[model samples]
Target: MPSEQVLLKPRLAPMIWLTETSAPVCVEISDGLRRTLFRRMSSLISGSLVGLIIIAILLYRNPIPAFFAWAAVDTILVLFRFAVIGRLMRILRDPSLRRPRDTLVVDAFIAGSVLWCAQIGVGAFLCMSLGDPVLAVFGTMLSTGIVGAMCARNPGSPRMVKLQMVLIIVPYAAGAAMGPEPWLWPIVLIAPLYLWGTISINRELHIDYLKMLMAQQESSHLALHCSLTGLPNRSSFKARLKAAERNASVLFLDLDGFKAVNDQHGHPAGDALLTAVGERIRGCVPDPADVARLGGDEFAILVHADDERTIPAIATRLIAEVARPYALPTGLVVRVGLSIGIATRRDADNDPMLLLPEADQALYEAKRAGKGTYRWFQPANDADLSSQVRELRDMLPKAQTVREHGFEAGLSVTRA
Candidate 1:
């Protein structure tokens, strides 16, 4: 699956559920139905086994070859259904088999249900045609039990259950219309009503299950994301950083003079400033999900870049863009500067835990160089960074833009 789709599918679930859109159900819903059926597979199989044993004893004296053939087919189809389900579950567990979404795997499920359902109908029809009241009664009782069990168990996929119901009842009703028994003929008339009622019940149950699933998805989204900025929170960022262990770059950032804005105007102004900063950073990044708000006035970004210069270039742009003035809901406008630390993962940087610390140390270096300037993490410069910064400053012009030397122009608060 594509990474974007992985993020989007669950997010879209609630919208799909609430709207009752006529759009075709996607793979996620299909997989859930498969799992629901799997949970009830054991009980369904046990019931079938018991019914088969009883039917064998009931037919011991008559020895109808066609009935025996039908029983053999049913038994084989039961085994086939088990195999199909087992393979599908294994595919779900193994990530290697996840890509290129195979329709064959899901198709197997539909095919198996169709075969088993048709087999039950055929068995019922044969029993009715045998002209033995005892066998007919036994078959009818077994068929009714199987249908009811399926109705209860397979509501996760209503269409599948409905299809199975039709397959079973249609053939049985046909047999009722042709058989010698006048008492059983009423079944032919009652079949349509039975199917309609059961289908309606299945639809209701399926809707309830969907509502519950949507609630779970919404709660999970809330937990993983920041409530204020709608960016990934600290914990979620850590997990994604770990997933990108190789060839990763971390840009640790802090807003310069943010406390003064809070102390001068208030916390609400600070919050509005932070939200605007998040949106600006998100707009600049290649993937919006790469940005995170670790805490108040602190943010982090995970970048995938081909060359060493790409990381520094990104850091430079962030310093300029975030330094731009933010207009709040109130009439007041606020200005804040940004300090950035660039750290790239070397081949030796196998552990994800160390990247943040490395970036944080570099952030300290940038702050020391001059509040708005950026710095790359270099272990050798730690002991004497002040001297090196002075050396660089002496070589350049007294004033510089953020793009030229990561030193941005000053800003004054104004009325919007």
Candidate 2:
């Protein structure tokens, strides 16, 4: 079918000459480099054609016919080259084209034919033995060097590079071998050496590209994951929450006595405890749920659950699991409890910011009700606090800023 599709398909045998092993090349990287090389080569070819036209005018006694013919052919090729470059630029912007490789191959073959025609003209214009044979050797060397440089930039697939190099070089070599001069036959012998050198460069570049890809992958993984607990960090968690289903739920967990652990022991012990808690939370959650450490002693989980009962059940399990004792590196057994607040899409309007606040309010309620427990958000309970302040205002009409005063007084009363 399409050349892009063909390139993507698994190769029957992708032979690397040094290793004698088969491996699939990365299609995206290869195609991108090919487009870049095509642009460079096309510009170079157009410039060379203009130079050839100038030389033909100076060398030939009857140059008018040759000029017009060269002008016609060069104009067509230049227009076609621009069209291909435009298509490639569009592909770079939006990758929807079906057969980029096929387009490139067609252009390459046309370029090869042009080179063959130029070589034949040069051999006919001058004596075949004197000027033609020397031109043939020089042309072959220049073509080989250009192709090798282009191939170095795109060493993803050995087979594809080999094919493109063959298309460009074989025609020129054939022209040299079939020339009228018997001495020029030996020029074709250098073709194998040129191919071997190009292949060697391509193999080395391919190995380097593979190493770069692996390093990039490792860096990406480290960026998205927490260094301490190896869980998804806050940034990754929020991204997942944004893309999560509308029916998903979030559980916000804060350790009850984590600060005391840090005070009694040290920050290292606190970190160890947090790591253990993260592991327990991971074990308790199902595959569809993602656990993230949202800095310090706070953590979050995004659970895929459309059912009303699923949130509470998961939250309760998490609280129990997190409350379990953790054995530290120093052989010290420490206990900590979890205060969890759960908010579902039905309660939070499917907004993470709103969902988080709902969970936070519920978490405050859980801490007020006494830690080591979980709570679901209740809008009525929120309104009841304001109603209680209003009742205090009615009882004492002098209380103007009752909302702030009532909250402070409530905290004092709870402490007492």
> Residue-wise lDDT of candidate 1 within 242-301, one digit each (tens)?
887567889999999999998999988888889999999998787533999999999999
**What are the clash counts of all predictions, listed in order?**
0, 0
Clashing pairs in 1: none
Estimate candidate 2's alpha-carbon lDDT, on a 0 to 1 scale: 0.65
Best by TM-score: 1
Model 1 misplacement above 4 A: 1-34, 54-62, 89-103, 129-131, 260-269, 329-332, 380-416
Question: Candidates' lDDT values, in order?
Answer: 0.74, 0.65
Question: Tens-digit lDDT track for model 2 on 106-155?
Answer: 34433443443354344223322233544444444445554656467555
Candidate 2 RMSD to the correct structure: 8.8
